[model samples]
Target: MKERIMSKDLMNKIDALGAQEYMSDAQLAVFEEHLRGEHERLIVRQQEITNTSMKNPESISGDEADKANAIQSSADARAESEKNKAMLRSVSVALQAIKTRDYGYCIKCGEEIGLKRMISQPAACRDIECETLEERKNKQNPAANLKIS
Candidate 1:
């Protein structure tokens, strides 16, 4: 059987739990501020990389080594930009979850994810057990990483 709560009771429960048991309003605000800062920084960095020089002055004289070095630098910057983009998405999703009253619960097990874990990684979606299992699976099937998506 399912239980029902009165609106007032539900509100009280929400207040007591603070929507997310582990996350407080102040903490959310702080995290949001940091996330926005990081997002902006990454966005700016990726844009800056787009405008970066493809060759140094020495490379302008047709030096193969300098040309190769410039290519490597561009590739590394692009890789970093991709990494930052992923993190930015995670932060955006975390902020949305915080706003939508789903921030502290584990997506895999529906358990309270705990204050420490949420504080340490605001973008976490699963509990430690689920994450560990996922890691084990990833290690066991390294070929999965090589598959073209």
Candidate 2:
């Protein structure tokens, strides 16, 4: 009896996808745990800031200054929360890419992203070659640089 063989392209895609699935899922779990820890830490720090601000009421002569302090603390907490949430979103996107079996190829060049790159940054969308080109292009783009006149 002849042995059934898998197609080469299919096998390659499967292997790449499997590797990404494992790495992405494991990393996602780790990141979720880290996010929880960070959330707790942020809450504690925010509480401390709020408590300190409240205790310094004498420093503010009027309600406006107190309100300004409160607003600053709120904005700081919000920025931290936004950063954490954005990281979570990236992990979720990587997981979705794994599910779709589109995880390990350079989005711009349609080439396989190297294992080293994927291992280091699983959510990467470009291989080194394409990424380098993109970096060069961005560097050359006048609009990418901010100048003060």
Candidate 3:
């Protein structure tokens, strides 16, 4: 699945970015394999949600609170699944950036994103500088200030 997301050309681009004589190909191969496993797991989770949608009946209970809680849980699960789908799409975009030789650099500032940051947030497009500024802007935006909690 990981290979499917990013093609052989993408791998060659990543290699060019590394530009070192040292053998880092094995490490990248391992990481890609891990990502493939994760993709399979996500597929299973999506399938589970689909199955649940078909099998789950409307909950009825003597205690109204219990029924309400069950409904809320289902709603939360659906919301989370939607979020995962968004993240997967972001991952695809990131892979495209990698192919374009623009991965691990801030789109706004052209600074190299630290290895730790990329490992922790592979789909991140901006480095800390740009992201922090963006966060401040969002915080100041009226729409972002809407109370959700």
Q: Highest lDDT, which number?
A: 1
Sorted on TM-score, highest at the top, how do the candidates line up? 1, 3, 2
The model with the greatest TM-score is 1
Off by over 4 Å in 1: 1-21, 53-61, 143-149
lDDT of 1 at 3: 13
> lDDT tens string, model 2, 1-149?
11112123323443555555433655444433433444455456656655554544335466887868766776675666555555556556655656665666788887878655654554567889999998999889958765467
Give the per-residue lDDT digits (tens) of candidate 3, residues 36-133. Answer: 55556667777777666542436455487877766777787788788767766666666566557676678899887765566566567898889999
Better of 1 and 2 by TM-score: 1
Quote the positional error of residue 101 for candidate 1 in Å: 1.6
Cα deviation of 84 in candidate 3 (Å)?
Answer: 1.1
Extract clashing residue pairs from model 1: none
Candidate 1 backbone clash number: 0
lDDT value for candidate 3?
Answer: 0.63
Name the TM-score of candidate 3: 0.63
Quote each prediction's TM-score: 0.68, 0.44, 0.63
TM-score of predicted structure 2: 0.44
Model 1: per-residue Cα lDDT over 1-149, one tens digit each: 11123223333433555545255675566556655665677678767766673445345555788767767887787777677678878877877877887776787888877755655565777788888988899899988767375
